[model samples]
Target: MTSRSHSLRDAIEEQIAVGELRPGQHLDETELATRFGVSRTPIREALIQLASMGLVVIRPRRGAVVAEIAPQQLVEMFEVMAELEAMCGRLAARRMFTEEHAQLQAAHDACREAREAVDSDEYYYRNEAFHEQIYAGSHNAFLAEQARNLHRRLRPYRRLQLRVRDRVATSFSEHQEIVDAIVAGDGERTAALLRDHIMIQGQRFADLIASLAHLSNKAA
Candidate 1:
């Protein structure tokens, strides 16, 4: 992808993160083209990139819209995330201890810095890196790639959640828990904890999305 395409993709993703874009809403090519001071060609390419990331859907004649994440789909994503994290933990249990454990530790420390700075986006980014270590630690490149993609698609929603009161402390504690499990080579604890971690995301998505809709109606 060209720099232009990547910039456009990041723009949309940022819009989603800040709730400037909503689900089930079409992205007008002309509008985006005008906003970005680009032609329709790059706008089309950008939408395709977003589509590949599962952040939007471009249908024949129907046009492109921000993807509507259904409750069922969130649950399914959690299920897949759990399985992926479990695979990482199970493999890391056998194949990891020194190198990978250090990587996870470094990420946790970075998260700690972000926590101290009270930077929500940075914390979210570091949290992802902390998990990425475990996925890569599993020594399974394919699994790591898949988990990273899913995690990317979920980034915007996760950022919104980090603003919840005391969320940074909560997440910090969870990271420490996972690091401890990995250090101990306890696959059961790692897997179960990771599974619960992802399930909480699904539940939070459902609750927050519902509340957001209600607030929109009340304000209108």
Candidate 2:
């Protein structure tokens, strides 16, 4: 992507994050171009990127709109994602090579840097790389592929999880535990930690649902 498209993409994502562009809200290329002082071409490219990330839905005739997921469906997807990630952690603990372990540590360090900077958006991107390292470390091609597919589908919702109050710090601490377990070659401990790490629980789940509801209402 060109610099224009990259900037436009970040602009649009920020708009969505701030509820300026709400779920199910139609995106007009011409209007976005006008608002951003860019042409339709870059706007279109940015929208495509958003669609690929599951942030927006692109229809044949209806154009692009912010993607919407029912709360129950969102929970279900997260549950599945949790299981997939747990599996990756388990396999990674058993199968990761020396070089892969080093890479995973590097990703974790990058996440720590993002956390130190208190940049949730930066942490969000780095968190993805951190998980990708786990998937690759799993050393199971089919499992990694399946995990990646679900991971992509849950990308937007996962990103929203970070928006919860103080979630970044808590998540980083959990990541540290997970990394320690993996490095210690404790497959069971790693799997259990990872399962809890990604699985939204009592209050967190409630907060996530409320946040999603707020976004949906604002969009409506």
Model 2 quality (TM-score): 0.77
Question: Model 2: number of clashes?
Answer: 0
> Where does the lowest 10-residue lDDT sum fall in candidate 2?
14-23
- Summarize candidate 1's per-residue lDDT along 81-178 as a digit string, tens digits: 77888887777766785977788899999999999999977898788788878888888899888888887777656666677667788889887888
Model 1 residue 117 distance off true place after TM-score fit, in angstroms? 3.2
Q: Give the whole-model CA lDDT for all candidates, comma-separated.
A: 0.80, 0.87
- Candidate 2 residues lying further than 4 Å off, grouped into runs, are 1-21, 29-55, 58-61, 214-220
Displacement of the residue 202 alpha carbon in candidate 2, Å: 1.7
Query: Model 2: clashing residue pairs?
Result: none
Residue 170 in candidate 1, Cα distance off native in Å: 1.3
List, in order, the clash count of every candidate structure: 0, 0
Q: Give residue 79's lDDT in candidate 2 (0 to 100).
A: 89
